[model samples]
Target: MFHHRERRARTPAHETALDCLEAGITAALPKEVVSSTVDLDGKTFAVGDAAYDLDEYDRLLVLGGGKASGGFAAALADRLGSRLDGGAVVTTNVDTAAAGPIDVREGDHPTPTERNVQATAEILERAGSATGETLVLAIVTGGASALWCAPATDLTLSDLQRTTDALLASGASIDEINAVRKHCSAIKGGQLARAAAPATVVTLAISDVVGDDPSVIGSGPTVPDASTFGDALAVLDRYDIRDSVPESVVDRLERGADGELAETPDENDPAVAENEGDWHCLANGRTAIDAARDVARERGYEPLVLSSRLGGEASEVGRVHAGVAAEIAAGGDPVERPAIVLSGGEVTVTVDGDGTGGPNQELALATALELADTGTDAILASVDTDGIDGPTDAAGAIVDRESIPPDESETARRALAENDVYDALDDRSALLRTGYTGTNVNDLRVLVVPAAD
Candidate 1:
């Protein structure tokens, strides 16, 4: 699915890295995952290892919001066909038309908009109307936190927007950002489970968060929220942006924490306990990484999966990856030469300059600089599994020794310092632009090193 695949694979190592990346991304595609995990046989429907008798339920309703919700819903609908009564899903991909009984509504991502608010309201309404005899299929995936926007009664859409902006700009981790989001949102943090209480709600999730914590994915709309409003307030305080955030946000959180308002359902909550066994994660970062590993072996490289939970500043992570590559190239301590190092997880980018770039681009640029400084002959590539890195059109970027010569090391350093890696990579045709890849498991990084000449 890498659109500029031929152009990006300039060397044997680059080709191997791209091949591994494509394997990882394709493994996590929503359609493929859903079709493989869900099956129907007359009145018997099965998801994963669990089976349900369709005849027992009066209606089958689908409801959810996320980047993959559209594709997931479409795939499920293809299997259920007329069995699906009616439903609604919110998503950022507006290009894909609704293919089945489920209504696909447009929503925003990374930031919630008025359209997101409207579309999410419809999803909540459908979820709330579910009965005990109704079987609800919930698709919870990455970017759902922003796409499923449903502001609390005390807060407006603007209040949520300002708080979301502040938290994202603060370079907070996804868990921390989601902690604040759960408290501010009406449909998040197990509230959707509350809305669909008594109904047999089955959630099919494609995890993007590290550790695959159900409570963090899509801000845990279908699962219990272990975090409280006090925790949300603490996140803002930890970021040191509580005062700068919208006043309404602070007041609402303060009131909720003070016990004047109801808190999000925790593990003890009845609705959460009832559907605890129903939540299933069909795919995750490891699922993608495993696929990459097989491709690496087939390509005659020793694949070393460093970790699937890698996180931290994008550039700092790049430096670490560079160090490992240096080790392999110097003496092959970790493994013999002709090794493919892989890692997966979300990375954060602290925007200090007005330059345009995402975490993956920044990491690739930083890795290029480090490899040049250490005189390592290796190639590094990083990309968001969703095919959109940050707000840029490029998925991410690839860099190597040839991409950044010795004379241009200082220029690359300056570009990285200004967080303008996009411009530099664009000029060199190093950016990987694949449009939307129809899935998101997190960020994937690949370092390819050939045997010593």
Candidate 2:
């Protein structure tokens, strides 16, 4: 992810899923992916399992947004160099050093801002000017929602702020949030690609969503979308949050969903493809899981990937992971001593009261408290590779038997109540702060159960 930079290997839980996420993240990085992924399955940089020639394209253009968009674009520039024309990209953890010929712009997460609106327009304009020979290389990674923000016309930035805060607090899923995002933006929902008609576009994505659907990752700037404004409204209504959203925002979506506005183009639509744009997923949840599996086996631990499609409340996911740890500590149904349980997926936060922790930190805190087995030693950690989880400063938190507080009593409940697990972990010196890992592979959780009883 860092292009051979010397960031220290953190004392993360030496579990499979975490290892895999780290590796999968490493593998898809522009530097590593271009180098190692060549000739895989007897193909090179193919689309839909068919390798394509890289030399035929006149100039490679990099344009995309997400948490890792900057890093991926930089890596592509390094490998493809003078072959790359210029383009635009947005990310949360953009490396200033890697900001090459591409326009690197930063934006907010979980919420859209005025700055995002400005940057997004530039992206659309750049895409609009592409040619038939243009090889548009898109780098889509996690944290694209906040990084690639563009609220609807009728709504103000204030509306986006409130609606986003409400939706996030309402416990909505990532899919639901993105559904709303696709409808409200000009650049998202394939508009960015629509602007680049007649250009040969190649989208290189790192999937942070549960399913690696092109339309869902960073709102599918190049891919056709199937969701409608009505679907987005249903999400809001289902959460009993219709009134909470801005009036103008609701009206626009209502109009769009009612068929008054054209739905996002489908691949079968005549307007696209001849638009000559194609997208490929460079990395995803499965990629992270695979990486962890290899590392677990090498470490002499029986590795198990719980699941990469984890969602719902962050605390609930933690409970489930904790249950697995308990079973292993007690009866050992799945595996015996020295086991690693790793999971990769974007978890949701159902904001009820108030909490200062993101899903990852919440997951770590919840898991630490749940696994109260006496005869077992397990080190559990949860982290977002992009360095920001929800609205917190630390990437995530770590919890081991030794790391647990002597009086983990009062603070745990209060932490959940106030959404301040980050502060709690901060007090305990268990917060994992990596600044930025230079890549976004979504959330990673590591549960390490050592054989030493």
Backbone clashes, each candidate: 0, 11
- TM-score, per-candidate, Cα-based: 0.98, 0.88
Q: What is the lDDT of candidate 2?
A: 0.71
| Residue-by-residue lDDT tens digits, candidate 2, 366-411 | 7777764342467776878666787877777667655555477566
Q: All models: lDDT?
A: 0.90, 0.71
What CA root-mean-square deviation does each model show from the true structure? Answer: 1.2, 3.9
Write down the TM-score for model 2. Answer: 0.88
Question: Which candidate leads in lDDT?
Answer: 1
In candidate 1, residue 338 scores what lDDT?
93
